[model samples]
Every structure is written in structure tokens, then in C-alpha cells.
Target: MSDHAPESGPRRRLRLRTLLLALPLAGLLLSLLLVLPLRWLAPVTSAFMIAVRLDDEAGRWPEYRWVPYEAISAQLALAVLAGEDQRFAEHHGFDTVEIERALSAADQGSKLRGASTISQQVAKNLFLWSGRSYVRKALEAWFTLLIEACWSKRRILEMHLNLAQYGPRTFGAEAAAQRFFGKPAWDLDAGEAARLAAVLPNPRLYRVEAPNATVRTRERHIRTQMRNLGGTGFLDRLSE
Candidate 1:
């Protein structure tokens, strides 16, 4: 035997332990550094800026304007909750029920639907790229946990509203409100909020200014959902 040492024994165990410890420590540090700042400072840009720029020439100059959670109307907030994640306030970060539904659909060979909640959407839109890769999804979950740990539910919703895409090159509730209704987000009435929220599934295909039949049906469903969810009281309950 030539003096070659097999890579095993106590030394290997030591290295393995070090790596395991290092990973958690690094994750903790990353969470603190990134998530803490978001409590005060709004993100100037997001991963969407990267994804969009690759597609359209005009996407290079994306539209995004952040507004405080208070500035956006209650109706808009309720509409989004009703439209996107009805259990947003109830769950920590993930919705197991929705996940189960998605898994069941996959098992049945039925059309699959995204089960991402508002928090996950915020995390992805703010930090990660849009993709179907397992690595991307794992990172999205990590970011989502960081966000849930660092920010309030209200803040999460507010950020989602601001960062979420509304139309081609249009972002934020304020911008969407302006582009679609010619008014600020704060002034969006219930009907307008529902209409805007309805287009969230495919903003590019839906029109807020003149909602077609499909959008109208979705809008009606959202309104009914809002009522079924007991209105904005659900948000208050979530905070408690």
C-alpha cells in the first residue's frame, strides 16, 4: 500500500459534522441579513426584473412601485386573499390542504394547479426565479420561511400586492390601478378590486379595463368568496 489513506474514520466524521453545522449557521445568517432589512426597507427590484427582461425588449424597464400596506384598500387585500389564498391567514407558510389537492391531481393525471400561497409568491417574486426545478422550489420554501419568520402577515400580503404582476410590464397595485382603472390603489372600490384580483391567474390574458366573459365569471367568483370568507374580518382574525 502506497501511503494513500482511505477517506474514512474520525477525520471524515469530523468533516461531515462541520459541514452539517456550517449549513444551518449559514442559513441562519442569510435569514437574518436578508429578512431583517425587509422589515424596514422595501426591495428596489426583484427576480421578476430578471425573468421579464429576458423575454421582451420593453421588459428591460419593468414597472414596479411600492406602497405601504395601509395605503392599499381593505377591499383589494380581501380580494387577493379571496382570489389567491383563502387560508393565507391560517397557515404559517404552506397550505397543506392545497398541496394535497395538487398531489392528488398529479396522481390522477388531471390538470395540475399551483398551490403556492401569497407568502410563497412574495418570496419567489422578491427573491427567486420562476421555474419547475426542485432546487428552485427548495430555495423558494427557504425564502418563504425567512419571510414568515421576519415579517408580519399584513406585511407579507402588502408586499405580495405590490410585487405581484398585474399586466404586461405592469406591477404593484398602484400601477395596476392606474393602468386599468385610472385611479390609485387606495381608492379601489369592491367591484374594481375584485375585477383586478380576478386577472391574477393570467394577467396577460385578462383585461381589467374591459373584463371579458371569463374575467367577469372569475370576478363574480372572487366576490362570492370574499363574502364566504366573512369579509376582511378574516385578516383581523389572522393577526390575532
Candidate 2:
């Protein structure tokens, strides 16, 4: 300090500018580090699963079984796509049409419906916490973009099938199929798959074991939608 001259204002500003420029680059690199390897590596668990385990009152961890995409029933995949995000193969990450519809519904004095695509759900379930905050949303968007860029549509759907909550204290197709239908995920028929897909909006409330009126309605609707989606043939788009 005694030998060196005082830092000039321009030098301080340049340093600040350099740091500002570096921040996003650093973030991108970190994000890539987190996402790239997941292409081949199946995640042992997700952030939502961790939170579920930590918040359990009886020390009972949620059920989760990671079945490879091929091991999971193609019917289940089509069921979820029909029930949750029909445009899964078309959109890169976000479903702009659904977003616009939600925004328009809110403007018309209706409740804001979720427009999250399977890819976005994968990003949120795997990496982020559950929240409705703008900060969380911005992060979700950032991660969604990274995932779409890093992984294919099929990988994104595979992650969703393995990570989404299907019933209370149950996560993933294999776990849900075993818990509810007493069968493996690959053996789940179209009806069972649709029933599981039906409760995805709120698994805690919608009981797969005891389908209430609403759950039954959603199950029927999902089955019909699955048929309209051309059964499992609709999944051919994922391969493209």
C-alpha cells in the first residue's frame, strides 16, 4: 500500500464491469457442470424427494424407483403426456401457447393455471424447490433452458416419468405401479397408467388407492385423452 498508487475511478469501474460480465459466464459453466453428466447418469434422488424425506413426521421416506426409459411402460409415458403436456415434443422448454392461455385466463378473472411443460417440470423437480415466487420462476426458466439445451426431448420426458410425484409418499412410475396396482411399471396397462397420471396435479390429495369422484373423472379423461393422442404411437415423436 505504501509503494503502490491509489486505484483510479476508471480502474474500479473496469473491475466492476469485468465482474459483472464474468458472473453470467460463471453461472453458465456451473450449470453445465451440474447438467451435462445427467445425460447418462440417472439421478439417485431429486430436490423434491430430499424435501419430502426431511419433512416426514414419522421418519418414513417416500418410495422411489428409477426405471430406465425402456423399462417404463410406453402407455404410462403417453398417459402423462396426454394428461399433463400434450405439446411436450413440440416445445423446446416452455409451452408458449399454454402460457398465453393461462395469462389470458387470469385476465378474464379466472385462476392462473400452471403451464409447466414436462421439460420445465423436470428442471424444477430435479434442481429446484417448490415455490410460486418470481425468483424461483426465473431460476426455473434458467434451468429449463439449460436442460433443453443439454438434454433431448426423450431424456426430459424420461426424467419427468422418474421424478414426478404420483401418489402420497410415492414418486416415479415403478413406485406408483407397485404401490397402487401391485405391478411393475413396465406391466402397467393403459387404465392403470391413466389412473396414475390423473393424480399428478396434486398427488397428496388425489388418492390412487381410493379414487374419489374427481380422481375418477380425471382418470377417465386421461384415458380418453390417451386414446385421442393415438395411444403409444404418439411417443414416436420423442424418438424424432
Candidate 3:
């Protein structure tokens, strides 16, 4: 019983409510701080690469060599767009059509296929861990929005090319090019680019070094999609 009165219940509740309300805004501001600089500065490493390095199951160091967008071949970029997200240039960050289709499939008692857009994948690979948890998905969504708002479509795809896993040990187009094709990423032709993009679904299982029947089929499909997308001209949309 000092002169000061004890804290009132209503005031304590109001304080708690205010703190809870401010938390998400604070988190968003912090995320903006993290993503805005990446528009100009290329990431040195990604969360996925770090996870791979720390993984006990992964015996060796991952192969990741950063290459600027110019250093990577346009063929490879087009191939990735063809294989991963066909509507990449059209969408902002999320692909509503793909998500709706996936949800419809699940409602029909079919398996839910992955519907992540390139922007979402860039967010996940660059910033988050692998999981289906609501928290992870929420964070991914937040980062996806931040990235789309902060970086250009070109920067998003550039990050994807550098961060995506191409092989068990390979972590970028440059590494995949040097390891599999024995050439620099800049020299990769369409066929080579398509092959590399084909194994992206499950890189650890699908070998780019030795194309399985599935890999070959996907490679052919990607090449067809590339042609359907009007060849490398589709990539020009990234700048706009």
C-alpha cells in the first residue's frame, strides 16, 4: 500500500488488447524492412540453402553460386516459367485460378496439388522453412505480398533461378549448368534448360544428370509450353 493505486482490471485488459493489435503491424513493418533492400541487393543465401546445409541427412555442402539475371540464359528463365507457373507474368503474387483448381480437386476427394506461384515460391525459398503449418503459410503469404510490393517481377524470377534446387546438391542454375551440362549458365540452350527445369518438382528424386521417363516427359512438355508461351519473348513481360 504505497500511495500509488493498484492496476485496474479494465486498464490491464485494454493494454493487453493494444499490445495484441500492435503485434501484427510491427511484424509487417519488420518484414518490409527485410524485403525492400533485396530489390537492389541480391541475396547471398536463402533459408532453404541454410536448411540444406544444416540438415543431418544432407551429407555434403550444397552447390550454390549466385549469378545475376544477365548471367543466366533467357532460355532457362522461359523454361522455368513454362514448367512452374504459366501465368507468372499475368498474376501479381498469388495465382487465384490455380488455388481454386487445387481447392476444387480437394473437394472432389482428389489429392491437392501444389498451387504455389513463382512469387510465392520465391517468398518461401528465400525466407521460410518447408512445412504445411498455418504459421508457415501465413508467414509465406506475408513475405509474398512484401516481395511483390517491393521487388520487380524480374527480381522475383531472378531470385527463383538462384535459389531453386536443381539437384540433390545443386542449388542454382549456374551450379546445375556447370555440374550437369559442363557449361556456364549463360550458354545453356533450350533443350538443356528444359531438362534442368523438368526436375524442379522433386529435384532430389528426379535426376537431371540421368533423365528418367517422367523427367523426359516433363522436359518435352516444358518445351511445348515454352513454344506456346511464344518462346523467349514471354520473358520480356518481366521488365514491364
> What's each prediction's TM-score?
0.87, 0.95, 0.94
Off by over 4 Å in 3: 1-3, 56-60
Clashing pairs in 3: none
Order by lDDT, highest first: 3, 2, 1
Candidate number that wins on lDDT, 1 or 3: 3
Tens digits of per-residue lDDT for model 3, 115-208: 9998999999999999799999999998998888888889999999998999976899999999999999999999999999999989989999
Looking at model 2, report the run of 10 residues with the lowest lDDT sum.
Answer: 231-240
In model 1, what is the error at residue 117, expressed in angstroms? 0.7
Predicted structure 3: lDDT: 0.92
Top model by lDDT, which number? 3
| Candidate 1 local lDDT, 1-240, one digit each (tens) | 769878879889999999999999998897679778987888887888667877876547677778998889889999999999988888999999999999999999988889999999998888888769999999899989888888888889888899888888888998998888888889999899999899988887997877899999999999999999888777785551
Assess candidate 2 and give its lDDT: 0.91
Q: How far in Å is the alpha carbon of 20 misplaced in model 3? A: 1.7
Better of 2 and 3 by TM-score: 2
Error of 2 at 141 (Å): 0.8
Give lDDT tens digits, candidate 2, residues 68-114. 99999999999999999999888889899999999999999999899
